[model samples]
Target: MNRVWLPVVAVQGLWLRSTLRLASAPGGGVSGTVPGPAAEPLRLAVLGDSTAAGCGVTGDEEAFAASLAREVAARAGRPVAWQAVGQFGATSRRIRFRLVPRLDDDLDLVVLLAGANDVLAGRGPDLWREDLTGILAGLADRAHRVAIAGIPPFIRFPAIPATLARHLGERAAALDAVTREVCRQSARTTTFLEQPAGTPPADFFSTDRFHPSTHGYRLWAQDVAAQLIPDQPAP
Candidate 1:
C-alpha cells in the first residue's frame, strides 16, 4: 500500500512544502516557572523537534511546554521550572546527539517529543529504536524520570492530504511501537505518553493546520500531567 501511495505522497508533500509557509518558533528564553507555593521547583526539560519548539504559537507562554509545566505544577502543588530544547527539522538521531548534551543533571523530569520527523522521512523502525535507546540512556543520567511523547497523528492533521497522511500515520504507528518497547525495557526511569484521547483535531491545530494551537497545548498538557504526576494530588 505504501508503495502504491509513495509517488502520490511525494508529489503532494512537495506541493505542500512549496505552498505552505513554515511557522516561526517562539522567541526568548525557552525556560520559565509556573508559580505555586512550593519552595522548590520540579525541573523539566522538553526535547525534540518543531512541535517541541512550540512553532504554532506566537509566544513561549502559550506553547505546550509552558502548559505542561503549569499542569504539572498545579497538580504537584509545587512550582515547575521548565525548558524546551527543540529544533525545526530535527530527527531522533539529532536529539540523541545534539539536544541531550544540553541538559543539566539531577533534574526532576524530562519529556521527549520526537519521532515526527523520523516518521515523515520514512526512516525504519530499527534506526528509530536505536536512537531512542541511546537518548533514553543519556537521559537516565540527567533526570530522575523521563517521558516519551508518542508520535503525532499525521492522518488527523488537516494540513496533510489523505494519501500522504495515511502513509505517514502508519509510519508514526510503527515508530511509536518501537518507542513503546524502548520505554518498557527502560521502565525503571522511562514511560511513554500518548496524545490525549477525544481531542478535536480541528481545534487542536493552529493556522498552519499542522502544529498545535494553544488549545491543543493545554489539552495535551492535561493529559501529560495526569501520566507524569499520577500520584500527585490534583490542584
Candidate 2:
C-alpha cells in the first residue's frame, strides 16, 4: 500500500521545502483594458495563491490573471479590466480573511485558484470545506460571477516526488470534490473549473521546476476562457 512510502514521502517533502527556491509574487497593472466588442470592459479579479500571483514568471502579464482576462475578453467580445490579487503560499482560510475583504462589489468576474497550500499544510477536509465555502460565499456577494480553479494533479508535477505527489494528488482530488459540491449548490452565480488532464511536460514548469511557467499559465487560460464565457450572464 502507499502508506508504506509515507516515511520517504515525508523526507522528500522536507527536502523539497528546504532546497527549492520559491518564485516571488508579481505586481502592477492597476488598470488596463483587453480590447473586445463590448463597450465597457469586463472587470476581472484573479485571486488565490501562486497561480493568481503569477509567481514563477518575470512579470504580471505572463501570469494567469492577464492571460485569463485576455482569453475571456477575446471569447466574450468584451474588453476586460483586470487585477491580480494573491500571495505566494496562501491557503483558502488565509485568502478568505486577507484577500476577500479587499475586493469591491463592482467586479464582473472572479477566478480563484486555491487549495494547494491547504493540501500541503495537511489541513483536514472539514476545515477546507468551511474555508472554501466562506471564500465562495464572500465573492458571490461581490462579483457578478465567481469561477474557481480545480486543484492541479500533483502526481504529475515533475518537481514533486511520486510517493508524496500521489498522496497530495489524492488529497487535492478530495478538496476538488468538496469545491465542486459547493459550486453545485450555487449553480446560478458560481462555476468550478476543472484542472486540465494528462501528464505535464517539462515546459509546464518554470526554472524552479515547482510553480507554473508562462507557457503553462497560457494553456490554462485557454481552457478557463472556453469554459467560463458560455455561462449565462450573471444578474
Candidate 3:
C-alpha cells in the first residue's frame, strides 16, 4: 500500500532566536544579549535512540540533530547549538537513566525521538509510556519547550523479518498513540511532526536498514525543521 506522509512545514527563523533567549537568560549559563538585527540561534537538545544518534548515518552532518541545526541556521540567519544524547539500542527507560540528571533549564528546545528500540526489545507499551512521561516531566521541571516525534512505521524497512514487520508496525503505532496523548496532556511540549506508516522506504537508510542514511537524516531534518522553525510558507 502507498502511504502518503505529511510534508514538513517551514518555521519562522525568529522562533529559534526567541527559544535561545528564553533558554539563556541572565540567571542561566547562556549569556550575551539576544541579537537584534541578526537573530540568535536556538539551543536544541535531542535525546533518544540510535536514530537520534545517527546510528546508520556516517557523520554528524547526516545526523538528524546536526542537520536540524544546519537547517535552522540557514533559515534563521543565525547559528544553532544542538546537544544530542543518544545511544544505540537505547529504550525510553535507558534514556531516562542517562538524560534526566543532566538536564538544565537553559535548553531552548528538546526533541524526544525514541521507542523503536523498546518495541524491538519487546518492551510493554505501558512501560514505554511511563518512561516517556518521566522524561517529559523532567524536561518541564527544567522549564524547556519540547517536541516529540512519532515513531515511524518500521515494517516497510528492508531489515527485519517480514513476519515481525507487521507486529513491529503495530507496536510502533501503539507507541505513537501514547506519545500523542502525553503531548496533549503536557502544556510545556508539543507533537508537531508525524512520520506515517506504509510510506515507500527511502534510500537514506543504511545497509542495516535500521538507521537513516545521510539522505534519510536530511529528510528527517526537513521534517523537524518545519516544526521547530517559526511560521514559514508551505513548500
TM-score of each: 0.92, 0.92, 0.76
TM-score winner between candidates 1 and 3: 1
Candidate 3 residue spans exceeding 4 A from truth: 1-37, 103-105, 196-202, 230-235
- By lDDT, the candidates rank as 1, 2, 3
lDDT of 3 by residue, 1-235 (tens): 1222211101222332234221111111112222223555577777777766667655555667777777766767676767777767778998888855665567778787888878767787799889988887777665368888887676666655454566667878788888888877874466646773346446866666656777777777777777767567789
* RMSD score of candidate 1 (Å): 2.3
Q: In candidate 1, what residue range of length 10 has the lowest lDDT sum?
A: 20-29
TM-score, candidate number 1: 0.92
Higher-scoring candidate on lDDT, 1 or 3? 1
Worst window of 10 by summed lDDT in candidate 3: 21-30
